[model samples]
Target: MRIQKRTAVAVAVALIGSLTLIGAGTVTATAEETSVALPSASFRDIVVDGVHDRVFVSDPTGGSIVVTDYAGTVVQQITAEEGAAGLALSADSSTLYVALSTAGAIAEIDTATLTETHRYPTGSDTSPQNLAMAGGKLWFGYTVGSSGGIGSLDVASADPAATLVPSGRYWYYAPALASSPADPDVLVAGEEGVSPATLAVYDTATGGLQKRAERLFTSSPSISFLNDFAVTADGQNIVVAANNPYDHQIVRLSDLSSNGSYSSWQFPNAVAVATDGTVATGAVGDFVKTYRPGSTWPSLHEYGVNDLQRDGLAWAPDENRLFAITGFSYGSAPTLHVLPDAGKLDTTLDVQAPATSRKGKDLTVTGRLSAAEPFPAGTTVEVTRTDAEHPAGTPVGTFPVSTATGEFTFTERPRGTGDITYTATYKGDGLHTAATSQTTVTITK
Candidate 1:
């Protein structure tokens, strides 16, 4: 397999296709602002299998998928039979399932062997797009061979002794797949002209209807022709993608385990949740809404990715990677980008502070932490300066992130000028916290 090092622009040198990074000049926005610099790497499709310790990405145009370590080196590559589009890695990250949309077949690849060992016949016109793994079975999207509409395939559970679960159910056009929130139910996200595109769940043990959202397909005029989803952890949520009029959404899974009943919990956009436990979504023209579990309405935040637009997003189990799949709409293979380390995401820092000083004056740099989540008081928040450097006179003191509201302050009088940066060592309880960048203050002279 051809492995290429990253170039500034996705050049036309060959294996995949030309991945040009036509850089644009810097543009700016506010709190809903252009704060963090966009991340580097990109792939056609990106999936991080924490169980396997590597990321799996599909190369539809290239006809192969490249696997890489957390450090971003190509570790393995799987070339599909013909037109490889959909990719599904098992929960354990050992087996991989690839869909041959044109060939109307699904090939199961042994990740360890990096080889295709099992193949199933889906009929012609069966355009398999994305495949999902659940309850040790494989479910993929398809178009009916005859009438031609969406459908799915289910592989039977194999006997424990056999590694290959060879005998199982293979379906089409009946009950299509619906997306779910971190649950074990098989989920599919779109339907033909149906409102809200019904999200259904079947019992893994019975392969029968356990629960579903009957008219979720009818969010008329708001959402349409939806398909495919990236589920949140616990499968309690999923971000829906629809085209033929493209728009996106992050909706909640109807919790049905309790009564095998139907319900819609009004969740939205899986990508927003990828940022933190918070779910953020809506059209660019609409408000960029944000919310966690207990909040009333989602708080609004807005910004643009000058060179990038995200159609899908994922959060790792370790919660350190806020990753996105880019280049889907522009006809380029998806680029896998890792933005702001998860450890750095500090919700504890989302509270309001007392104040700041005059540009040239030596003011105490300080703020109050929200509470004790992952980063409590005493957590080290590292400070660095850009532009001209913290105007020479500011005394750099390490302040404590208060345990109560986490009120923290550092005595750093101005030396000169700078784009002040704070790298917080957040031991906070939030999902995205690894080492987050606090607001960058520019000191003026």
Candidate 2:
């Protein structure tokens, strides 16, 4: 694996690598350069192994999977032949799985040894692609015969439970499968390889159809395949990439919620989602790098990922340091870049005062932590008053949490107050404070 140095200039109307603000014209932020590593395969597949803070890049060209630490060191490399393509890892992060499109078999790699421990044939004439490993089993998209959808292989025990469960026998070609981060079910995105490509959701655990949708936005007759997208780590949400013909926009799953049409949500990516379900996606409308749940304003300042030729995209548990992978022609191999890019974490703290207050008297305010993205777990969140519309040190309360979650709600309602200030601070790991987000309520005294 090698890394290179390159610069990405933002679109005239788009910010290169920033998170978007709600109603502002895109803002641009500058990133400092840091070392990083690029996959040996020019066309590579990437998956995050959160259990170890390591991300594995599958290089079909080299028949290897390159393992890089958070600091961008190539710690290990596992090689395989037959040109491996799609990749998957178990929910517990114990195994590394691959789809050998040419080999017509799913190859299993033990992350411990980086060696091929097992391989199962899909069919004599099968083309298996994009994999998702979860719930004591492995799932894949198999474009075999007149069948489409996904196939399953369970390697939970020594008996070798490998079974192919085709979702629907549509004429659809290759598709991508990912287990829902928020649920036990799985979501499968596929296209018929022509106009009106289809994206379907299936229950691989039970072979039940949850949803199958068509009318996906695509302009080309021979449409572009969905490269990479993600489901949230919690498993309740799923986002997919569907390039609408000449129109490019990451589709949103919320859009599909209305009719359960599978027509709702949108987000684009080449490869996405870490084991924890932290996703980094490519942008469609204005900027280059974007993450969904809808882009906020601040991301514009950081520069969304642009210039794929220069950098590869990565997400961090901190939600602040984004590792950009790049390649340069070195004397022996391409240069490895684990470029450290910083992202703005606009975390705000909000708490309801006397949340369930009775009528009339003013309830005291306490601070709570709300985040755009997950930081680290076990981080502290403090509560405080903004200014002297009141007094200082008004008996503030605090809590500890992993900055890596949606939000944390703490109830330490203050009593007998006209006005009060509460602050949440994350001490240790350096001192950090949330923007004072507050709310007020009234109760009968």
For all candidates in order, the CA lDDT equals 0.45, 0.50
Candidate 2, run of 10 with poorest lDDT: 16-25
**Per-model tally of clashing residue pairs:** 64, 70
For 1-445, candidate 2 gives per-residue lDDT tens digits of 1122112321321331122221111212223444554547543456666667776776666766778876667888776645577777777767888888778888888776677888888776887876876555677777777655566776776766456664554646666665665665656555634555555555545543445444354432223544445565555544444443322223434333321112212323333443344344443322233333334222322333333321135555544344543333232233333433333433333344443453343443333343334456666556554333445454345566544442445554334434333444443221122344344333234
**TM-score of each candidate?**
0.57, 0.59
lDDT of 1 by residue, 328-426 (tens): 445554454444342232243321112333565655444433321334434654444333444442324355665554445565555655455543333
lDDT of 1: 0.45
Q: Estimate the overall C-alpha local distance difference test score of candidate 2.
A: 0.50
Model 1 Cα shift for residue 31 (angstroms): 18
In model 1, what is the error at residue 311, expressed in angstroms?
5.3
